[model samples]
Target: MFFQAGASMVENQNADAILLAGTDLGLAFDGHDPGYRVIDALALHVAALTDLATSGRG
Candidate 1:
């Protein structure tokens, strides 16, 4: 409920996107929506790392 309420509050304030910066926040938002754009930092980090690994640019 804490995460949901915070996200809703941010959305109410007209935020373009709510960032979930904590890695453990997935527990609160994995399959949930707070009626706004939510960017999960951990997910993005993982995606970037995966892309870099596959890009072979080392």
Candidate 2:
């Protein structure tokens, strides 16, 4: 699930997420460029997954 906002040259589709390699830019740069919206979305998704996992519905 790798989302690159500008990497695609197509005009009709887009990526939903991105999985960058640790060796590409190190952990310090992880998600830093995505800013708060991306972080918040990820947090919400994580929280929902956690809830589902804890409830044995995942």
Candidate 3:
């Protein structure tokens, strides 16, 4: 279902990827591919934090 919707949006808008806001929505894409690119905003934020932490850059 998610894939279909995303596909439609991609086709209609020529989008390269899908943006998913909200912190808890990662569960939907976990261990599964939606047949297109779907980026979880929360995950990207966390990953940026993790990288900063590891790099010792405040």
Candidate 4:
């Protein structure tokens, strides 16, 4: 997963944008996964990149 994330980040020209995937488990399961947090962080990075691009900073 980390490798994939790195690849994606590299492909984006090392931009600060990221993508995340979220899932919901059954009632018997209720916990957060580290992967999810990683994804969230990536997403934030991506968003910042987008903002920069739109602002002509990229």
lDDT of 1 by residue, 1-58 (tens): 7566667777678667778799887668888766777889999999999999999974
Cα error, candidate 1, residue 9 (Å): 3.5
| Model 2: number of backbone collisions | 5
The candidate, 1 or 3, that scores higher on TM-score is: 1
Go through the candidates in order and give each one's C-alpha lDDT: 0.79, 0.45, 0.84, 0.48
Question: Which candidate leads the pack in lDDT?
Answer: 3
Number of clashes in every candidate structure?
Answer: 0, 5, 0, 7
Window of ten residues with lowest summed lDDT in model 3 = 21-30
**Winner of 1 and 2 under TM-score:** 1
TM-score of each: 0.76, 0.33, 0.74, 0.32
Model 1 misplaced stretches (Cα beyond 4 Å): none
The best-first sequence of candidates by TM-score reads: 1, 3, 2, 4
- Any idea how many clashes model 4 has? 7
Who is ahead in lDDT, 1 or 3?
3
Using TM-score as the measure, name the better of candidate 1 and candidate 4.
1
Candidate 3 — which residues are off by over 4 angstroms?
A: none
Candidate 4 clash pair list: 16-45, 16-46, 17-45, 17-46, 18-42, 18-43, 18-46
Q: Candidate 4, which segments miss by more than 4 Å at Cα? A: 1-39
- Give the alpha carbon lDDT tens digit for every residue of 1-58 in model 4: 5446545665666645433443321111234332222345444567899999899868
lDDT of 2 at 50: 94
